[model samples]
Target chain A: MAKENKTNINRRQFLKSTAIAAASMAAIGAGVTYIQKYKRDENNAQELLRPPGAIDEDAFLYACIKCGLCVQICPVHAIKFAGINEDLAYGTPYINAREQACDFSCDSIQCAETCPTAALYFIQFKEAGLKAIEAVQQQGPEALKNINPFEVQVVAMKKVTHIGVAKLNEKTCLAVKGKGFSGTPRGENFNGVLRPQSIKNQDGSKIRKAYPLKEQKYEREICDLCVTECPIGEEAITLKKTTNPDGSVSYKPNVLEGCTGCGVCEMICPTEPASIVIEAGKTYEEVYS
Target chain B: MSLFSKKREPLPPKKNDEMPHSKLGMPYKEWMGMNEDRHKWRNRRWAFLVFINLLFVISFALDLSLLEGSLSGSRLLGFYLLDPYNSFQLLAISIKTEYLPYLTMNFVIGFFTIVIFYSIMGGRSFCSWVCPYHFLAEWAEKLHDYLVKKKKIKEHSFQRGLRYVFWAGFILLAFFTQRLVFETLNPVGILSRAMIYGPGLILLWVLVIIAFEIVYSKRFWCRYVCPIGATWSIIGNISPVAVKFELDKCGHCRKCQDVCLVPHELWFVTRGKATNEKHYVGSDCTRCGYCVDVCPGDALNFTVKGLDKIL
Candidate 1:
């Protein structure tokens, strides 16, 4: 009878311990997942400006390993990893255009090339680059004399790269305010670098050299940095003279379908807090419409 | 008794009490003074941790082709290296056929390289030797021990098996959410990335986990919640490198068990308890060498499955 009692106590103790462990595990697991679900909802709502060649935002979030390879390979130093507060997007690379923009001066989308996972799907740009080269090849040797195949390939690659669309805030725009401000767009303290349109690379291969904004000076009758400094040029954005309600001519920057939302316009804007900003992950149709 | 009140035990003489005071009459000792004998394995582990993690920082700063990228994924001299746990989470999230193409051959090679390397080194060696978070947690554990010894707090513990449940939970979380859900809050990845890319707000999460270890339980995250450790523990099952025990050499002092990170693995080392003359530590053992370090009789030792005979 005593032996039976001892066995019963041992079994009871084992059951009790197991029950506690099971209960605790269940509680902790459910708690963590619950918090994660809440954070994930908040995370998905964030529309971040991703690196060039990034896929659709939802799919990109799923596919990105948060490796930061894109951040390392970006020659312009445009990409930065998202903070923990970004939740699901934490450690994922994003371009803060105001800080630095993808100038595409590398003539190669190195970030996309280095991406092990096709989170930044390079094949789209790769196909576009191939098509540009193929078109030049088809045009015979005469086309090659006038046209730089490498430059055309890079431009075509840039066209396919839609990270976001630039939206203009007309109220804060210096051009709309009818102001002709001079000196550097950003002050002498600004550290942002860009491959200026006037400066050509010594190599003449169309891979432009980047210079700090502090070192470059700009004199304009009206602020047209967004238009003049655009890497994609006239196809992406244009400054147009529009007649206002007072019958006064006001210059406005017009965004077109060719806008890659590479965010050069947003980065170069002289106005504090930026007069123009990229609506991250928005397509040309979505922004214009 | 009140709900929060506890029975206070009388304090014993601390190690600091016996040590001579400084010239200024302040209590002084070696920084993080552990009175125990010089731990060779622990020193080697700290060195490896510092060197490996430093390469990640140096490579990025100098733009060296060696060991680029953080722990999540890296290129060692243009060769890919991926954290197996993080890679597995990616696999779970992108399990669909269409997504398979996105996961390139480089990822496969990186994953296998990490697996093979860890397996050869005895799997959980990564936890003790290479994981920066593990090193931090060890410091937190020392603080925890000090608190416990000083009678300031009691040691709170949980079933170590909870980690296996967490391991499965993370994979399922990835599958259901279609995201690397844990990476957002993973301390291991956060610490590793912080070293390479400077600290971010995510480091707050790591701080909270460490605080939990110190105040609530000793090594809470590592012992009960780390999916990375759990994943390696599974790989450790097949690992040939193990902590071998000789029954005759054991003094029955049980000091090894006292120092073991996972004490359950060394349960058979008790006096007259082990069935075999020689027994190998269980898969759950981190093979951290704490047991070997603390063993006065030199009973416990690191031994490769077949290498001991040749040596």
Candidate 2:
């Protein structure tokens, strides 16, 4: 009886050990299978011919560090970051110039210049070739074909609208307070103010004197923050020429397209409180219009 | 004469007393017997794991076409399998000058897959089972072992710290130059590009590493210099899955430590002790489970941490 019990115990132990070994082996086998599947898929995918214009497919695959500089600096904002698409090649980086084509004419090669990873090469304006122009023309027709030109859709137009113009209140105007058109010596507290009709240039290059006239000439140039501070390349507020009654030409301010509705111009206006304001309006029309 | 009668004539009942304890340390037989059952379990796990890895390699090769410019059905399958949108552009930038937008989806997916897998199993699954780089490195190390007589290299704490510094420098360089210098040097990239563009100096450099692996050590490059490995390691921390060691059950045999390709410093970290003055192990681990297979104690097991647990 004792011998039989001992034999039975040994057999049970052996079977249990074998079972454990088999189980572990199976688990490891499954894991290895998964890895093999993943590698095979990855390898097979790598062999396909890259899309047209792909330079070094392998380097680009590893080198691209996703930074949004190209998208930010694109003049037409044509570049957009790609999202996950399983059917497509590994979603790394690609240009979609169908919407807003690459405007190579922009002064700064900001996209390439600002890219944190030389994922984008910086090409000089001349070197960028005819592709830049072709891209723009292609985009123009494509964009127009998609929708109504005057429609107020977000995708169709730049999203800034002019609100209002800067106004100088005479009572608070620096020139009315005897503080000169340029305001304080430090130029910090420059309320919109006109200079006295006759004043000496700060430098002694021209000799002149101030005269207290009965009526002040409102100098349009006194407050140029709106014209100078706009983020758009061409300032939103631009100086336009107008003929006066005396047959002399004078300059007046005009707002141009491409304003981003970022109120830097209004914020920087040199009034006690800002004189320039972006009031809500339709199509950025004039206050009287 | 009858069999029973003969035995009776010689019979003095045999003494059945237990043997007295000898003070010359525990007997080897008893010590080994006590651990034999546990060791069997471990050895079995190890063998099974290796077999699985072999299967995976076979499957991958069967499915993928490594040849260049071959428009096989597998190539189409590869395209559908690995989305190449951004990867194509990145490769272009690496070879020539071109501007393309950077997209994060692929990186995020690759990162998340490793993290998710690590959380489900222990770290070794990735190294032993999934990572192609680990396989390459291991093959290299095996060659090294064969040629150099299986000598071990001692990894100091400072060497681990240097990896972090190297990764930081890579990031800074990319920030300044807007180029992935590290990726340019990556062996995988070199191989793939060479296959596509034909062999060049870059391919020659990668070939040297392969030679080194065959003769010197397995995974020498991955342990020492892979930036992608470093990236995965940092991300792997949040992985809820890890190998849990039962210290009480461990026999102090150090078998698990021996098979581990990652530095031993990591095991020290997993045990809740700081190794090399760092709180966490450096990111060289691919979580391959070789260590679990070699353990004699059956001390290691995979476990999940709660959501509140810090990765």
Candidate 3:
């Protein structure tokens, strides 16, 4: 009888630990299932205005280690790491252009260069970089390329690929009303970066000094800051003339494919929410969805 | 010399023990009873812990916010400090990086390799020896002691049953959100970022969790909430390298029990209640060697399996 009792106790102990191990596995399985059940479908994919060289939405999620390297590398301090509240976007880097725009002040696109995983590919901005490199390599520094080999790189970067498309809300546009802006675009207290009017030196080189929007004023009869001051210049946007119902000719800004969605136009628009907004992702398709 | 490695010491063989205490070809050190080698081993482990934590904290900080070109990733020298929660989240959520030329799959391979190695080495060894949060948690416990000295408070309220509950809940949350949801609550993550970018939301969470620990519970996160701890416990259940108790040598002093982080683990392991014929032995031991260091009778020593004769 005592021998049987010893076997029984050993059997019970065996069962107890086995149950615990099985329970741990079961718990993990259930938790994974619960998450899979409620996980957002692909339709919920955020059409984020990712930093310049990011890959596809689904691929980006898997590959990004959330190391925040790109965020630290942006010269304009435009990139921000998504916080926990961003949900699936958490730990990824993004640009909230209204708050800060990637001005490409660092002409080499340093963020892409710094990405260890290459999640932000330098190739997206490569056409311009390649063109500039070729121009300098093939044509000597003294050769007059239509665009300065250096400027061509940055300006062409604003042309080839885009973060998103800029859309103008006609009803709220100041130019639609034939009204122009005067004084700082964001007003006296704004903290956004403002380029001191680009001026051509006697040597034919352009020099740009920066002043905060709160400190500078651009007075105009037609609101053309979005077109004229655009880093992409005439390539990204142009002021088109139109006649209003009152027989006054007004200029409406037409955003071309060259408008690389820098959001500088949006920031300097002088409108409260800015009439032109950059809808994130290439083309406007499926952005809202 | 490696700040992250633990030097294995051979336990003194019992008079009639079957297995050889030292593996073949190893030079055996004399087991001079209760000597400085014992104390030096414990002190070295502590110093190694501090060295590892400070080394990473500096490099992680400099590489993160200060440096131009830096060595990157959470892995170095084949050691991965990843918590299981983060690794599992990376898999379940299907996270990918945008625009990068290479695959983020490198992390996946490293994460799994570390998990397998940890399971073999006796799990939670990382937690006790290498985790930056371990020392912080210990300091928090010290603060709790100081607080209790001035007032009246119970030591710890560890409920073992609730461990898997929070563990699974975090995993489910990671899955549902398709994000590393628990990183917000991870003190290690919080501290690393705090060291780099200065104080922010995650640091605030760290302060709150540590303060919550000092006032309300002891080692509460590791005991009741860490999913990684739960995963390690499951994988490490049969690790050959574990703390073995020579029951006959024990004096019933209870010193080992007082220093153990896990509740009643020392009691059951020492009393042979957790280890009997047909039952596997380890009880979520961190292998921190605290109980081994504190044992007055030289009874508790880390050893490989086949020591069930004590039962």
Q: Provide C-alpha RMSD values for all models, in order.
A: 9.2, 24.9, 9.4
Error of 1 at A142 (Å): 6.4
Tens-place lDDT per residue, model 2, A192-220, is: 22212133357733222212222223233
lDDT values of the candidates? Answer: 0.77, 0.40, 0.61
User: Per-residue lDDT of A1-289 in model 1, one digit per residue for the tens?
Assistant: 9999987887776566556655654564465456545755665424357889888666776677777777776777888887756544567788878889988877889888777777888888889999999989899998889987888898889888887888899999999888876888889898888988744568755436788988888888888999988888899889989887988898988888888888888878999989998887777887787
How do these models rank on DockQ, best leading?
1, 3, 2
Estimate, for each residue in B9-99, the C-alpha lDDT of model 2 and write its tens digit. Answer: 2213222221111222455345324433344433554565455434433333342323111100011221211212223324444344333
* Every candidate's chain B TM-score: 0.85, 0.56, 0.72
Q: What is the DockQ of each candidate?
A: 0.28, 0.03, 0.12
User: Which 10-residue window in model 3 chain B sums to the lowest lDDT?
Assistant: B18-27
- Considering the two chains of model 2, state its CAPRI-style docking category: incorrect
Question: For candidate 1, lDDT tens digit of each residue in B1-311?
Answer: 11122335323322333323332244333321323595988777688889999988888777777887777788888888887888787787777535877776777888898888777766478788778999999999999999999999999776676787678777777776666767766788899888887788878889999999998899988988888888888766667788988765655567787888888788766654666667778666777888887765577899997888798
TM-score top scorer = 1
Model 1: lDDT equals: 0.77
**Order the candidates by TM-score, highest first — what do you get?**
1, 3, 2
Model 1 ranges off by over 4 Å: A1-47, A85-88, A140-152, A201-207, A241-250, B1-36, B95-98, B247-250
For model 2, the local distance difference test gives: 0.40
User: Can you give the TM-score per candidate against the true fold?
Assistant: 0.83, 0.37, 0.60
